[model samples]
Target: MTITAVWPISSEQDPNAGDSMTITDPGEIETLVSRLSESTAGAATVWHEGRELADTDTQMHDHDVMALVAEGYGYLSYIDADHDYAVLDGDPASPAWNGEDVDFPKGSGVSPETLAEALREFLDSGERPESVEWQPAEW
Candidate 1:
């Protein structure tokens, strides 16, 4: 199982931009999922091979744990805002993280990188990350 992260890029920003990256390290995948779990306040859905993992929400950071344990690629989506959401694509076999513009159903969306970094640092330092660090993208 190989997981590649793909994001939507706005033509206004870069007409020839391709928003996708490959994540190959299992530790990095864990780091990404851990931060994602913290971002959602531990509220997120876990999917393995495109199927949701059961009994994950009830457990603490289960999404993060399940992702690490998944035999196949893992996908986690967190709805952090009314019109903003974050997604993590992790493959134990092969992984990639994409950075680009993502259009939402509401005609707007934001990049998850800032949030990921903040959460990552928070997890590493045990300090709360500030929301003002980065604002979600809008259209």
Candidate 2:
């Protein structure tokens, strides 16, 4: 299965700042999730279908992003991927646009089986993920 991760675009003022990115590889997704968990610092907001997953901020980092991806939920990538993951600092909106913001009401929580099914649907329909409602940001 191919997973796409998109981080918000960065600005030139803070070029070192990170954003988000889509991950197409399952192995990579797992790895990213693990890394985020390990590097988790404080609580982060997790949204799914317009609902908040965590009531309190608890280790908001890369793990959260990976979790979102696993759950098939879409998020606003207004910061760098690293800051979201590793507790690093980033620019609010230096000057860039990764892509249009998206929302996936059907996606919620982590479920490998569910994600696989969605991917299969894409593959079978001969439709690229970009065409779906929760389209990933362009590279």
Candidate 3:
């Protein structure tokens, strides 16, 4: 399935203020992951049908699937489709999201390869990724 990946063009600007690319094939996922893995400021959100994979009750736009890579580590999260669940990395670490460093919930740090596989899974399945262990978002 095809998906849209949105990311900030400048790490100094607002996270939401950025560009998007259309991913028609799974091969693109590795490239996207590589881009993110190379820079600490690299982050992106993959959207299906112009909507996040997770359901939100508020009118405000919230991310469903988000990934950030920094210092040879990556962070991934997505809202569970079956409920309002916050699926996060298995280890605790502060990664730059958008343009600021935010403290993520406790979870194990993931490698670039793992992050890429998770993105590919989400791209193909359009569901919460089964590759990473999920945890509740602390905040």
Estimate TM-scores for all models: 0.23, 0.23, 0.70
Clashes of each: 5, 24, 5
| TM-score for predicted model 2 compared with the true structure | 0.23
**Distance from true position, residue 78, model 2, in Å?**
22
lDDT by residue for model 1 over 5-121, one digit each (tens)? Answer: 333333556665434333444335455544433321222222222223335576333122112111122232333223244433222233332222222222112234433443344
| Minimal lDDT window, size 10, model 3 | 94-103
Q: What is the C-alpha RMSD of each candidate to the true structure, in Å?
A: 14.7, 16.7, 4.5
Task: List clashing residue pairs in candidate 3.
Answer: 90-107, 90-108, 91-107, 91-108, 92-107
Backbone clash total, candidate 1: 5
Global lDDT scores for all candidate models: 0.32, 0.30, 0.64
Q: Which stretches of candidate 2 lie over 4 Å from their true place?
A: 1-100, 106-110, 127-139
| Cα error, candidate 2, residue 58 (Å) | 44
Winner on TM-score (2 vs 3):
3
In model 1, how large is the Cα lDDT of residue 93? 38
What lDDT would candidate 2 get against the real structure? 0.30
What are the per-residue Cα lDDT tens digits for candidate 2 across 11-65? 5676544433244443454443333233211112222222222334662333232
Give the least accurate 10-residue stretch of model 1, judged by summed lDDT.
62-71
Which one wins by lDDT: 1 or 3? 3
